[model samples]
Target chain A: MNVFVLFKKEAKEQVKTYRLLIVAAVFLLFGLSTPLLFKFLPEILEMSGEGIPIEIPAFTPSDALKSYVNSLGQIGVLVAVLVAMGAIAQERERGTIIMTLSKPVGFGEFAVAKLAALVVTFLIGVALGALACFYYTTVLLGSVDVQAFLAINLLIALYFVVCLSITLMYSAFFKSQLAAGALALVTLLVMGIVSSIPPLAPYMPSALMGWGQSLAVEGGGSAWPALIISGAIIVAAVLAAWQVLSRKEL
Target chain B: MTEAIVCKGLSKRYGRLLALDNLDLHVEEKTIFGFLGPNGAGKTSALRILAGLSRATSGKAWVAGEEARLNSSVLQRRLGYLPEDPAFYNWMSANEYLTFVGELFKLPSAELAARRAELLALVDLAGAASRRIGGYSRGMKQRLGIAQALMNRPAVLLLDEPCSALDPIGRLEVLETLVKLKEQKTTVFMSSHILADVERVCDVVAVIDKGKLIVQAGVEELRQRFAHPVFELEFDQPADSAIPLLQKVPGVTRVVTENRAGGVPVLRVHVTDTAKARHGLLHAVETSNLALRRYEIVLPSLEEVFVELVANHKEQSR
Candidate 1:
């Protein structure tokens, strides 16, 4: 119940600070620009050629979806992490958490509420951005399957949650937001790199994003296990953060 | 009297640094208790443990008969804490912040609104309730912090140096609000190094030094326990003449005199019993027909007691 109350407060704060709008705008720009960027790739290459033979991939509507997913997957994860990097660090640094924690609110409640609020905000931003990209891709190149668009978008959102969790956990554990943000960025980057190895590909959460993109493109490659693992990791990270934060002195 | 707060051998440590030693404290219901200590004297640590925001490394704390640990939500419900530097979400308006705090306490909607209005008026922030906290002056922010702390109508209010950060005028404002809170019968336990503030508002006082309690008692009791009564008198008599006459009084233990450059000689009479000394001195003055310009009993100040106790504690430890 306290979590819900805190969630409401956090939601209002996100709106007041224009963080909601900024995140939505960032996602929207990516969505609107990805299709346009990919659709004119051949023309763009031809115009800038200096006798360099660039073997461009076929720019189909599927490629447009791939570009959109990759864009959201990479830049969107960063946006999500950076946006939430200050969730707990700022409160602790500014000493606002002191009075709040003195209430009947638990560390878990505070953390979960913050995560829920940001997840909703990020989800809404991603949905709007994805819709814009989906519309432009359909009109410019060709039609995209509605089911695949929804499924792929959901997978990318899950990835965003993972990044958000990492950022928030560090924010609770570290005193400085910059340190937390850097650590989260490094952790995600390392995971992303390591998960690409052939042996680890099936078990890694990053593989879910690849599977989602592939399915959207050629309607193949299931990543159900990876999706479940990523979801589990997110939950674990949040719990660990709560435990650490509960032990923290002021 | 019912115990509003109790700490039994509470201790806190950070690695090798012992922030709080084994400490015991008791606060009765509806009393304004002042925790007096210099900076880094572990006052905040004790308050935080009682507030349930931090845990003691050893020992235990209780609030309103409930165990108070870091995760003790039940006890937390009955405790209102204002940290040394109370911080708020700068973007939030005062009304919004108070509402947020009320929501955390799970107050019902109707009661929450009513309480909010009452608290805003109590702290004199009703006019600026809609202004963002970031735009608020330090005093306004402090008042808002106090309002939020009282939103739950907590059984015990723990304030860590509420007036230490304010200007003189701002300090007076907060002190005034606290005075009104006292009338509401809230059990207020505040920590401060500012002796005058504590002396003004506190019914009970505890002096702590270097992770140890130097003394804890009612303000009047502490003064009586550690301070001696001394009376200062100004007359036309010289030091040699005044000393013998004052010393001859029955309850007067000793008398010393100092001659000012261009004024009358002053006599300080140390007394064993103030009542006996007062009667004897007045009788002697009247009988002698002494032109008494000034005769005043110098009651010991809390500052003197605090300094003596802390200095003695430091010397003993050394």
Candidate 2:
């Protein structure tokens, strides 16, 4: 119960600090960018008012949500990785870890609370951006199924959580805040690289993003197995980090 | 007397170095016990072991009548420790820090609030409770450390060199507070090399050297046992035959004279008993007409006692 209360307190503090501003900015950027890109593409092709043979696809509210997912599944998650990389690592850098560990709450609960904070931020950011992008895209194009769009938004949120969890584990391992942040960015870059290759692409975590994005765009074709597998990997990685942490001296 | 803490052959190794070497201790409840030692003398290690911050490599400890390893939670609830040079969450205010610790100990909301207020005032940080700890001075931070340690109103308080970082005024104020706790019958265990602080606050004292306890006894008793008092005399003129003459006296074990600066003579007379020896030496001084310039009793200080004990140990080992 105390751990839960501490978790809530930490959550509130996290929101007050740059988390809210960062989430809002990213969401707003995605919300405005999605509709503008869809609305102006045909006009841009007509620049110099020349005859262009290519035709733009029928824009819909669903397209906007899909666009946002692709953006977030890549850029949005990358931003989150940067913001959360030092979440635990900064504590160790500033030596607050010793101060906090002196308290009675076990280390697992402490780590769990921090991970929960990142997940909450991800949910709020993705949810707000999805809602905005839906409105603007609908006005520009036409109405679409809200359920499908929201489903895609939820997937983006979960993907963000998965990304944040990995960085949190790295933050727990590294002593320096800079190392944690750098390693997180490097790890994500390596994921992107490995998944882009021809032979090894299917086995990489980046493939999850690409695969999940396509399913989200097609509306309801996505199976739950890949998401569940990623969730399992997150749990296992966090557990391994926690085990190493349990034996670490202050 | 109720024993609050009992350790048997406790030891802890850090790589090749032994921080604690088969240390044993028995502390009585409701008493102020001072652990006196120089730096790197394993005082911190012993305190950490009791507080569950560090594990012991061998032997066992009973804290509050429970095995330290077996009942750490129950023991931790009772033992409040403030480490030497404690680092706090600089971003948090004193009130928030205390609240965090209080919640960790599972105090109810009302209880935590009230205790936080009381401890802040007790440590003279009431006005600064809302200010960030990063801005606090070294003395203020040390006080906050003590306040956080006392949040649970623990039964056994272990302060590791709590006054070491403090300025003179801060040290005096903290020493006064510690002594007040002693009067309240709190079982307080504090470690320091400052004998004056220990003498001012603790009723029982333990002298530690090289990770070993040199002596542990009541303050007055240890003074009586290990520390020897002697009377020294200096004269303008050296007594030509005073050594043999002084040795012939009933109480005098030996008489020695050595040259001091300015070619003056100094007398060192060791006797079996301080009071009886001073009496006989004074008598000899008067009868000999030795042109005495100064006569003073060199009652060994705690530092002197400490140095002598350590020196004797080294000599015996060599």
Candidate 3:
């Protein structure tokens, strides 16, 4: 009950701060632009041409879908990090956590409640963004495969969950909001760079985003191992955050 | 009387700094217990340990017969704490924040609303209940902090410097609120360096210095134990001659003269026995050329007792 109450407060905070609106607007813009950019690229280039004939690759609906997934995997992850980087760090810095945790709520419950709130908001924002992309992909280009589109979006959502959890983990561990954000972005970038290597490709979380892009572009790859690894890491991050925060002097 | 809160050798060390050093404290139920100390005197460290926000390095504490620790949900439910600098979500109004806190305590909806209204009125914040906390003054925030702490009606309320950041009016308002809580038999353990504020509201006070307990006694007992008996005499004429005459009388320990607002000299007689000094002073004034305007016996205030106790403790430690 305490966890649910805390979750509600955090969700309300997100709404009050207009984080939900900012994320939704950013993702919706990505959704609208991804398809429109590809459809008009040849003509846009023609307008800037120097009279030399340029051969443009025949663009397909899959290209637009692939672009949408790529944008979410890259820019969408950044947006998630931006929204979640201050979830705990700001409260701790401001000494607000001292009052709230002085009640009957456990640190584990507090950490989990915050995580759940951000995840729920992230999921909703991503779903709405995915809907916008799907609508544009079908109307501007040819018809998209519904199953393949859902699968790619789901995989991308999992990738986003990993990003959000890492942001939360660093936010709990660090006292400075800017330091938490910098460290979370650095850690995610290192993970992405290291996971793309041939040896670690199958077991790394960063591969999930690539696999999501592949699925969207009709280049198939197994997402199960990355899914399992990312899921375990998410659990580990939440648990570690709870442990560190519970032992904190505040 | 029952012990609402107890700490046994409660010690907290932050790396090399000893925040609390083997401190033991007992707060009886239904009493306003004042934890008094200067800054860095470990008053806050002890209260935080009892509130279960921070752990003691080597000791244990209990609140309401249960061990005090963050993991004990049952124990936390019976304890309410207002931090030295109480902070809240600025985005929330006073009403919304208290409601959120009540929900965390899992209060029934109807009961929560009733208690919220009662506490808002108690803190004199009902009129501003709908305003965001960001717009509140420091005193307003302190009052709302108290209201939130009382929402659960816990067995005990731990306040750290509850009136430290308030103006005189704000301080008086908060003290009055705590005085009202005494009727409900709420055990309040509040810490402050403001001796006058403690003297006004707390029945019992424990003075701590250098992370150790110096003295623990009732306000009256503290005055009787550590304070000296004093008498003040205002003379229409210069009392320089009367000092020698007064000091000659037995039981009159020391005499000092000062000039009042109108340049009139007043004699302050430190006495060992008030009854003996009363007659001796009156007779001396009549016999001498000094014309006495008024003679009054002054009991020691808590401020004097606190200073004497802290100074004695410092000297003993040295």
Candidate 4:
């Protein structure tokens, strides 16, 4: 229970610093800027018409909105990973974990605190970006069902949480924060690649990406299995991380 | 005094290398106990076990009358430990660091603040409490380490080489603070290879070498038990005559001269016991009537005994 205090303290210390701000800024820029920038890309491509009778899809507000959402999906995952990259490794390297361990706090309490803090940070960044995307889409693409929009936002936020959980797993495994940060990013990419190969995409967390993408076409049902599995995956990853960390020597 | 700290056959192995070998230790309550060993002698490993930071490979230890292996996280709230080279969160100020440690112990807000202020002041860090620990000197860091250790008024405090990183002045201050801790009835188990620092504040000294405890006794008893009695004497005769007769004394082991002034005889005597040697020296002096100018008992310093014990162990190990 007191681990909440420790978690809150970590979260507070983290937010007061520039990490949270920078992450939000990067995602915010991606959320707000990518769609608008890509609106001109189709035009630019159509003018380039120097080859093979090239045709370009007409730029639409949905194209702009998907660009924004996809940017959030990709870079936001990176931001989440980087934000939590060293939660455990930082404490290990600084010997701060010794201080925490020397107290009544258990490894579960410590790891959970870090995991939850990252989840909350990811939620904050993605939620804000989703809000920006939602407003911009309303103005450009005309009103979609509010429910579909919120569902997509919810799915994006869930994807961000998946990244946070993976980052926590990496953070728990490495001695260097950089190792955790790098591994989390790589793991995300690997998950994406694994899902892209036929057949396996149905079960992978990265399938959530494809699921999020198809939300406009097939609605939320396309992602129900992915969402359910992502939930299962997050819990399994956290448990696996806990097992690895519980046995790890300080 | 009750035993505040006890370890029974505490064995730890780092794979093939045995860090601690069947180590048994008992430290009396309210006494400053020095846990001494050279580098890689498993001093840190032992202290870490006691602090509950690391688990033992084989055996168990107890701190403040409770078992100390695996459950040390529970013990963490009750005891304080400083690693050999304790690294702070370089990002936090000294006050911030101590407060963070205090919070980990679950000290309530007001109590935590007052305790942090008091401990910071005790280590002479009140003036620089706001300075980032990374910016502090080694001495300042060591002092802050002590303040943090004393934060909870832990019944059993374990310090791992508290003075090892400090300047001479910083060393003196930390040793003095440790002395104060002893007076406050906090049983302290401070580990170090520096005999002088141990001798300064610890009355009970436990010496571990090569992962085995060579001796664990009071500083006074250590000097009395590990070494033979020694005496320096000056007589008004040729030094050569005293050497033969001095060895002839029942308890005396060797006779070597330390000073001979203007042809006067001066000799240093190694005896098994000072009381018996005094009797023999008086008897030798009375029989020979050699005018005695200087006759004094010289006991071995802890440093000499430590070196001798470790060197002997090294020789025997090979």
| Candidate 4 local lDDT, A1-250, one digit each (tens) | 4687778777876776666678767767776675556555666665787654656665555566556667777677777887777888877877777766776777777778877777777667777776776666566555545666667667887888888888888888888989899888888888888888788878777666666666654455575677898898788778867776667778
lDDT tens digits, residue span A151-248, model 1 = 88888888889889989999999879999999999998898888879887777888878988897789778877788889898998899889889877
Candidate 1 off by > 4 Å: A45-58, B229-297
Please state the CAPRI-style docking class of candidate 2: acceptable
Candidates 1 and 3, the one with greater DockQ? 3
Candidate 2 chain B has its poorest 10 consecutive residues by lDDT at: B66-75
User: Backbone collision count in every prediction?
Assistant: 0, 0, 0, 0
Tens-digit lDDT track of model 1 for B1-318: 999888899889989989889899899988899998888999988988888878789999898899887878898888788888889999999999999988888889999999999999988899999988999887788878888999999888889989877888878888887777778888899998788999998999988888888889999899889876888888765545446667789988677675778677887777879988898987777666667888999986788678768878989999
Model 3 CA RMSD to the hidden true structure, in angstroms: 3.4
For each candidate, give its TM-score against the true structure: 0.88, 0.81, 0.91, 0.85
All-Cα superposition RMSD per candidate: 5.0, 5.9, 3.4, 5.5
Q: Provide the TM-score of chain B versus the true chain B for each model in turn.
A: 0.81, 0.82, 0.87, 0.81
Best by lDDT: 3
Candidate 3 residue runs with Cα over 4 Å from true position:
B231-295
Tens-digit lDDT track of model 2 for B126-187? 99999988899999999998888888777788899989899888999898887777677668
Give the alpha carbon lDDT tens digit for every residue of B51-154 in model 4.
88778887778888778865355677678888777777776898888887787777899999999989988999999999878798878888887788888889
- Select the stronger candidate by TM-score from 1 and 2: 1
Native contacts recovered, each model: 0.88, 0.26, 0.83, 0.55
Q: lDDT (0-100) at residue B117 of candidate 3? A: 95
Instruction: Rank by TM-score, highest first.
Output: 3, 1, 4, 2
Error of 1 at A9 (Å): 0.9
DockQ comparison, 2 vs 3, better candidate: 3
Residue A131 CA displacement from its true place in model 1, Å = 0.6
The TM-scores, chain A only, for the candidates as listed are 0.93, 0.86, 0.95, 0.86
